[model samples]
Target: MFTIEHDFDATVITLVDDPARHRQEDVTVNAFEDCVTLEQYDAQSDRVMRVTLSPAQVSDLAAALDLPEGVYKIGRKS
Candidate 1:
């Protein structure tokens, strides 16, 4: 596990694996303030991806992420 900082944005992105080699570009994420949870799974195989995020917006965090009130944040598993 490791932590990395990016120069272009407000949100801090963390990766558990070698995500730097992945082809996906930095995505614009929408969530509750700087707090959120993201999950991904491969339907073809049994690969699982689960992520829980903490809010990074320093301003009106709720407004910045556009998250609804009913949403619940996901906690880290490891």
Candidate 2:
């Protein structure tokens, strides 16, 4: 399950492992105007881990998901 909320500075999206209990901490994504952040709990480190991506990186990631095997470069539109 997932939930979405629009805040003043960013859009927050949380992914739940189980909808019924809602106890398990799942992944969270925060999208801001300039960048995006993905966060999840790390069992080994006993802390939350986060990854930040720039706008360009996010665009490349979106395209990479639908792409077939092989390396490719993402080009910007003029």
Candidate 3:
């Protein structure tokens, strides 16, 4: 399951793990104008861990998802 919300400065997306299966903590993604952040709770540390990605990195990651087992480059959109 998932939920999306539009905040004053960013869009927030929460991904929920299904209870029927061996579940994991929820992931929260925050998309800002200049960057994106992915966060997940760490029970062992008792804190939330976050990873930030720049616009270019986000673009590359998106392109990589649909790609095959080969090296590739993503051309920036003009």
| Candidate with maximal lDDT | 3
* Worst-scoring 10-residue span by lDDT in model 2: 16-25
lDDT computed for candidate 2: 0.92
Q: Kindly list the per-residue Cα lDDT of model 3 for residues 10-66, writing each as its tens digit.
A: 999999998966789999999999999999999999999999999999998999999
Better of 1 and 2 by lDDT: 2
Model 1: which ten-residue window has the lowest total lDDT? 23-32
Q: Rank candidates by TM-score, best first.
A: 3, 2, 1
What are the Cα lDDT values of the candidates?
A: 0.47, 0.92, 0.95
What clash count does candidate 3 reach? Answer: 0
In model 1, the runs with Cα more than 4 Å from the true position are 1-34, 43-45, 57-78
Q: Which RMSD values do the candidates have, in order?
A: 12.5, 3.3, 1.5
Residue lDDT tens for model 1, 1-78: 434454443434444444666643233332444465444555566665556566443334555477666645544345
Cα error, residue 13 of model 2, in Å, equals 0.7
In terms of lDDT, model 1 sits at 0.47
True-structure RMSD for candidate 2: 3.3
From the highest lDDT down, the ranking of the candidates is 3, 2, 1
Count of clashes, each model: 4, 0, 0
Runs of candidate 2 with Cα error greater than 4 angstroms are 18-25
